[model samples]
Target: MSRRLRLLVTTVGLAALAWLLLASIERAIALAERFEGLPQGVRWLVGGVLLLLVSLGAAVTVWWLRPRRPRAPVTAPDRTSLEARIAQLRHDDAGVEELRSELTELDRRRASARTYLAVFGEISTGKSSLIAAMVPGAAPASDARGGTTREVTHYETSAWGDGWTIADVPGSAEAGGEARERLARAEALRAHAVVYVCAGDLTRSQAEELRWLGDFGKPLVLAVNKADQWTDIERDQILQHVREQADGIPDAVLAISAGGEERFTRRLADGSTEDVTRRRPAQWQPLRDALRRLLAAGPSALEAQRENAVLASLHERTGERERAYRADEAERIVSRYARRAIVGAMAAVAPGSDLVIQGALAASMVRALASLHDVRVTDVEVDNLLRQVRMTLRTGTSVVLAVAGNALKAFPGLGTLGGGVLHAFAYALIFDSFGRALAATLAERQALDQADAGERMRELLNEVDASRLRRLADLTGEALRLRHEPSD
Candidate 1:
């Protein structure tokens, strides 16, 4: 019912109810007055009966006028259905399995409570020295030769009661370095932040390597080691060069001398040992402070990285699966339309009837292919595609049989049947070729704009083999004969 009509009906019914209620009260008062001359007990019983009837009437009216709640709408199981589809795709696709493994490992890393900071640099870049300076007693042997650290070394410590790990990975410039580089990159991928150490100004190759590291989307700190060897002016120049090479991605660039000069203990003439201090390099306090600031940003930074990585993976995998499903559906649609076109061609009674039936069939197939990709084309677009296919077929070798079929129509009796059969076969071949070409375009996610439609359609039609057309025509002929044959 309309809102105005319902309101009018409700108002009228309420007014009538109010009038009835008033009349009942008036009647009860009149009856009580009449009973005024009766016994007191009789008057009391009459009053009680009238009160019960009024209460029952009010209850009925309120129950009938109460508001009703609307029912909830049913929703599809999107998440469950998607999960099932993903599982099936994974079972059948190797790429999906690889992506799934990567996502699973990423999830595990995100769940870890401890933070990792990886130290990355080329060989002899003071990586070990910088780590030793920050860690005090946990110093590993520092060698000038390359490949000093062949495996990842973890140094665990507590700062402000929170546990943190520093990973010293192998240098990327070592002999047989491809494996080491892969391992170093994998370690860096799992780190919350990276501290890149360098001895002096960066070379062109080293600068490119730093840029590659920045692509991982983690916080970075650039630490220039062995600053004691460079003069103040040279140090400033080196720092500026390093900053330019870091591309504004590093949170901080710090200059520190991780390798202090050698100190010796000498025996004095009185047989006591004396300590001698030589040229002592500065401590790595600046690098430590920079790292502490990055850590202070807390777990939200790592969580954001995880969210981005997972979202990217989900989008890529979902698109791949959706395209695969659409491709399969497009093939099914083409096969269905091809069969229908064949049947329609076989039923043509006259030479010219084949054109009308085949034209309609081909247009339907084009629209069906577009629907598979969720694309909408105008009537003009469909007509253009059909015209292109028809023109191609008329100019190609397929034209000879079609022309001969039309020529046969001049004869009577058996010649009409033969001409109709020839026309139907030729039309079926054209429709089948057009459908396959359209399906290929949709599968490749190509747009059906006029600019490339003719060229793309011709290229696809040329790829259709003559043998396949002949085989399809013969099969259609046999199927039509079987369907029309009389049964015993």
Candidate 2:
């Protein structure tokens, strides 16, 4: 702005402030005069109330601005307790044999008493070349298109010290590489220390991986690979940025070249061009120095943290297995109850009382599913949940019967069974929808959510996929045949 305009704006701001100040002073004077006119007791009461209000406002301000404490990091249980938990899962038939195998491998590696280091990074980050440079005469496959390393390969190297073993694992961040990333992570946790290789500053995923390693207390070094591509100043800046990004996670952050092959065309004196391949000399002295310092503590000193990391990973795996087991068991229970509902509907002589008859079965199925998911539910809660389901089914009864009629027509064999089969199939859909809705709500909220389950039931009642209808029809047929069989 021009000098005159700037002056005008500044003057206006000052004038506004002065006007506000004068208005506040006048208001305070008027309040004082009114207070003097009041009785002494009322004046004291007013003053006390104003003091209390001001004190409360100050207290609230302080509370709003208070510094919050960070949440404590999660720690894995000791090996003995972790193994006990895994054994309990096995006894429960949770299919945790793979977790058991992980424990077995953990013990085997510990028994070897070797210092293990894993080279970890995303695809095409020179992880393989770095390994080849560290281990003489050891060449690992590398492709410019990425994902060349598919499995974990260990090389015994005495470069750092005796019994030092380096592991080369698959790279992370590949398309369809989630399985390989899991393998790479498990191997990293199995090691005494890890070197996270990156070509530049950390990406979001890379930073997260480093944080995960830190959470497991894994000893780490951040290596900025392919450093030969940048000049000295640029390399130094990148190293500083990497160090800041990794911060407390890695023991050291250094720039190094992994000595990869570069292909180019050479012209001879005869003027004919010849293809030539040359390997870049690896410049990883700083990396070597960092590894030496990290390993100076020896494998024995690092064993506790490594074991903790492995057990923590195993604990997570076991929990996943347990959830899967519960889900499968819940499905079986729902199918059983749904079959029972179909049989009950088929046998009922009175068509109008079918819903009243299925109410008890629905309640039973809810209890069964809740128990399977380890969700505690009271008798009152179960009754209330079933009441809600009954109301939902009442509203969607026509929709459910329509779906059942469509199912009967869809299957030629089922259509000849008569009208009773339509009622039976409707019951099957009802029980199936109710059971599934309750099971899902219990699994997610860990409590009986009447409103959510009722909404889900309404949705499931109208949803008649071909596969579901076929299964229900087959079940009705089987149940009817069994009922007609003579009592031996």
Candidate 3:
């Protein structure tokens, strides 16, 4: 709004508020005068009752409007149930041995009785310096440039307690450091406690990483490193802002200077300038105190949550592997069905008789794909799906035929293969479209989502892409060649 409009609204609002205040005062005075004539005991009792009612009402209102803490996004699945899922996935695809290894490591870590602490944050956020300060016995190299820590390094430190190891993980948000970020995150998950080091207020990515770590329900501390860079007042302000951004995610938010070498130019007696570097003393006592308090319960007491985090990570990794395996299997299944459709079309009695003849073949392909994805389907649903495919093919037969003709022209040699090659190619397109659509829908919805499948089928039917046409042409030629083979 314009300044004039804002001023007018403000003036009217203030005037209305003043009038309301005066009216309230006038009502209170009138009520007091009436109470003056009443018995003193009765008036006192009435006033007490009114005050109690008002207090109760205010308390209820405040309770209703209270702010609620946000729940974490990560959920730890039951260990037994998660193991069952990984076992079943391993049974289906033998490539998930790494997931099995993760479980094995989980058991090994639990048996070792070690408390792991991972320091995580963005690049050049003093994570290495913080680790160096936390563990006086070990020295982790720190640089002004970001991404100095390329690998996860564990330091055995007796400062906190025996069997307490701290991990110096690679900084996140570095240029082309996604793999290292993943490494950092995985290491963080393996730890019983995490110290998220930051030089200032939490960046958006830092906040998100903090939330992810917090969701695991681990002991997490948001440590603002390099506190010496700001004044005391400024440091407090930044800490408060970081706390607000972090909210209930971190157990505690503390500011500590992870002292590192400071570089400056020095002038000798001859007034010649020389570069000088000196190590600054670390002031990370607050962080040490916080971690001590967080880990006071010992490693064994925190093993359950640590296992849950590892299992949750494994579940996610195994799920990714399962999806990848299904995708590859779905491709093979679709190709096999498409080739069979081409052969069936070539063996048909009439030019377009394969449409009616291949109904059972199409239904079989759908069932196979659905079974691969663990989606059970009734025969009625299968038939209905095939019926929808038939209706879509009926409407787009001309487009399919046109695409086949174009493919024949594109590959002149295929045109001389046989008289029914066009029909064979069209059937290849139809079944290819149907199988791909069903596979995608099954993978996405894990159900017989007929509408979504039909829509995808329609789109694929009209997709006369060069690669697809070439593949179908090749399949049609192969089918014709196999049809003329001698019966041994």
Candidate 4:
């Protein structure tokens, strides 16, 4: 009801109470005057009975209408507090459960996606250029401002077979930036192998890149670009430079020319395939060979590309959901808190907690139980649990209240039984106790969720191979875990 309407009703009720009190007083005064004028014998009995009834009725009315105070609102967690909580959750048992769930899911998706052969190298090394040409097609042309290909492109060719996904990320600088982000995504995707590309003469920039990322290192497939343009002297010099770049790699360097040599082939309007082999422009054959070796080691490359495409899409959506769940954790806890408070306040006013209180308690209990499970929690998830609690509590309250009303009507206890104050007190005790207990229980559950969330994150991180992910999976696995896990 509107505040104005509520205020008006309260005033009316107060006025009625005052009028009834005044009437009783007036009746007593008149009776006293009558008894004073008549004999005193009959007056005592009538006066005593009237006073007792009025007193009892007044007490009952007060118990029914007295208001309970409102509860304080729950605030968003503090930044430092939230951070600490996130840290703490990482170390707990609940976190381990969460990690197990994420790891299992990631393992399934990675195998399904067949994300093998990640290309890692410095900018303009023709890493993108090479993958683009070999796959279904090239990435969409872009201005490439500041040499940043921030977009991690995926190329799929169903003709290759089932379950093939090829991931192409921005080139890595030893400094991270776009390449590092790409690598993180790659790790999540679970790429089976890595193809590291280095272009031209291989500057010191190439040597330091791998060492800088230390742990993010991957099995290297060193690809050298612009081999076609080099003279014999230049080739020797380049080969020497490439050796330094390959210093840390397990395999040898693979060279390719981004530009064709003296020979060139072009499609004519004749719609016929013709071979006019000029001196092979920088041959991508070396790069191609290395890629094939990677495939030979595992599943079909073509199928991997195709599967990667679909899995990439699913990974994204699921990741988004997980992040949201993490953020919503606090809200879920607060909701249960509010409901419990409501019930407690109601119980305080009513003697016994209403049907709403019981339903709320039950719902909170069930939700707390579920949050403890291995299943990932999200805001939508917890909200659904609380919603059921509310609905059940509301229904229960109505039923119980109705039954109580019927019993009261049938017995008419207030009219002739022991004082109503005793009944009011009893009802109030039940209601208040239920609300308090529910709140206490909900508080405990919230603590558990808050504590467990981080451990789960750590578990996920541990399950993924940092090197494998940095090279092949990119941020796919990270995305999946963040998406599935709820924010609290």
Candidate 5:
């Protein structure tokens, strides 16, 4: 259906559901006296029918509004097709060499980069101050007031040589979908170490978060906040909670008070430093020790010493080969056919066409692409393919917000210069759409070259905290390698 019609149906369906629910309640109230006199069997039928209709209507309405996708499972790939694609990728000999070279350079950089350290703790605690103390020019710690720190901040660390970064993610107790997605993306794309932070509350919520972090399969560290003023009773409860939560993860918790000016400047005798060690209570010493232990020995430090020697060699041979595979499928095979399928969808816009011609355009586009590629285009894929193309086009191509701004100011008409302005925008869109489709098709597999190394590196990093690791990624060649630099 057209977008307008689909929206209309949705509005109508919602109205219908509300009407049904309200009507059912009213009918039952009206029949209250009669209901008491009627046999139980008839009353059951009336109530059951009302509920069933409402449930069915709600389900359909939900399904209608959800984004559609091709029926294919996102994770599945048939071996035979994969093999065929791989076999074909061998032809791009020169481009493969260039890709290999780039991969080698990146690997060399990553392997030697200084690791980052993160200071994580929940609201009103002092993660901000902890980082601030470790790095000069860092912001002073402040009370969160509530679950406020909505933005993730980064601070450079003195301990992780140079080229290391520490990222502080916003803390949330009841994290929803966006929170999960943001954290997961940060975990996948950036976090070098994982610090599960919690504050004053020694309740079950902290236990739940800490418990899940245990299984994240990283070098887990717990940052229990506000230890300075913990009563003996609260202290014991907090320690017990920490011990139980850290179970299975062979790591220790860090304790430091980022609040108060004195604690903010507290320095340890060991090579390590604290943002607010002097101001917090004594229990935090053990946590600082745990943070120290993480950097003491591991493959991560060894890899940094050697740089990217092994991975570089591997990429020099395999890098470009992967990109060629994606290019073949997307540019030559998938997108070429996809455009044809989309043009076919235009048939629906033709006035007074037959029902099949008008309605099947959307369905036909999905089926045609799958058939041409000799692949199964699942229902989910059907819904998302065009949308994916459109989304990619919007981002991969420059938006030229400047042009959009001008057009809005003019506010041209349907048949006037305004019309011409719309045409210009339309032209820009067409160029962007076709360009993105072609480019994404070509580069879809480009990331495959780094996927393994990225995962391996992230695994090592996640064993720690993101704040510190990001420092490593963001620095220049020289700053990332020095280990003895004095830290906060």
Candidate 6:
């Protein structure tokens, strides 16, 4: 009921209650006067009973008229429900599917008992010889010249009954080697631990490659092969240099000879001793021991590394998809608000009315943008943003357009239409730029502050192209014109 009607009813009811109370008091007085000649004790008992009944009635009325508490609001849905709703809106099915595939692969890898230890290095780094030595009777061909191995070669064996695979990657120094390098890195990413073999001091590129492999957070062992080829001092210098260059990589660095030739004494048939030179078997026992210790660190460590790699890949893929989605959504928002601004401009009847209508339209656009991006903004913040925009326009190209539009309004005939079109185009451009800037800021999950938002708006306006604005205005005009045509 209306407030006035409720007050009227309350007043009438109160007056009736007062009248009844007065009548009851009058009757009680009359009764007391009639009982004045009776015994004093009997009259007192009757008065007490009447007083108790009146008090009980007054208490009941007060209880009935008291206010009630309001009902609680409905509860919100759970997080999973909210996430499902967001997914539906975002429509990121492809990214989600790719993530599912990666996770499934990770689970499969975890179920396997084999531990892969990939050997990564430049060409002619003895990676092949090292693998051959690590696995007896599994010698792979090698050459003195670099780029001998053109593909990834895997040697499978068992160490102390635990299955292991040693992968030898082709030298990454060939012409058009970027593709091969990428493939090698991909192989390294899948390895539980890495063994990087180099015959000499690490080059700048080699150091960078080592660092890149270590970025996957796997255990790495740097083996300086051909240790017997250099003097003791030179070997120490190489080790120290590699350690300095590689920084945190190489859980342990060992000196070993995988292909160094050695001289041995031979007895001739003519009772004379002769010296014979031959390629010695690879002596990589220290390197093997280091690798064994790394693998023995337990399955938990390996699983953790695998999980990190998979999660990192998933994060990157999902991040790319989210960025693309946000960009597309932002463009749609700008186009939508630009069209709305154009409509408001076309309806302008006076020069001053253009400013008021455009300002209100921009405010509405800002509100819609905040809602779409899930940004929390207050009316005061929105008003501040609009004020900044107006201040900026007053001293820029928009001012020139505003003056031209007003001058066009002074003429007759086609002048009015020209003026409205100019006004509409100018407002449309301004709202479009503002919407894009707001979208970008919200995409970064930032609060809408006046100073930063104003700066972004000004930057976007400065970067605006005349041709693009003209095209947008033309498209909007064409759309509006088409809508006004009579149906067939």
**Per-model TM values vs. the true structure:** 0.47, 0.78, 0.82, 0.34, 0.36, 0.62
lDDT string for model 5 (1-488, tens) is 79999999999999999999999999978888787777899889978998999999999999987764422212223334433443445555664443334344435435646554444444445656555555647542331212223455655555544555566655544346466334432321233455555664445755654544433334557766666667777777876766655553536654445554553555688967767444432335565567567655643654432222223323323435654454454444433332333333232232112223323443453354344334555666544544443443344323323333343344333214333233333332232233333344324432212233223322332233343222222221112123226776
Sliding window of 10 residues with minimal summed lDDT for model 6: 70-79
RMSD in angstroms, all models? Answer: 25.7, 9.3, 8.4, 34.7, 23.7, 29.4
Off by over 4 Å in 6: 1-96, 121-156, 166-187, 197-199, 203-216, 225-229, 256-283, 349-364, 371-374, 397-417, 464-467, 470-474, 484-488
Which residue pairs collide in model 1, if any?
Answer: none
Count backbone overlaps in model 3.
0
lDDT of 5: 0.45
CA displacement after TM-score superposition, residue 274 of candidate 3 (Å): 0.6
**Best-fitting candidate, scored by TM-score:** 3
lDDT of 4 by residue, 7-126 (tens): 999999999999999999999899778877765777777778889999999999999777633222122333344333344343544533433343344446545555455666677677
lDDT winner between candidates 3 and 4: 3
In model 3, which runs have C-alpha deviations exceeding 4 angstroms?
1-65, 70-73, 88-95, 139-150, 348-353
Question: Residues 4-55, candidate 6, lDDT per residue (tens digit)?
Answer: 9999999999999999999999998998788897788988997899899999
Per-residue CA lDDT of candidate 1, range 363-431, in tens?
787788887776888899888876766566556634535443443343233235554466555555555
- Model 1, 190: alpha-carbon shift in Å? 4.7
Whole-model Cα lDDT per candidate? 0.66, 0.83, 0.82, 0.48, 0.45, 0.70
Clashes of 5: 51
Candidate 1 global lDDT = 0.66
For candidate 3, lDDT tens digit of each residue in 250-349?
9899999999899999989998999999998899889888888998999999887887787778778878988988888888898898898888877655
Using TM-score as the yardstick, the better of models 3 and 4 is 3
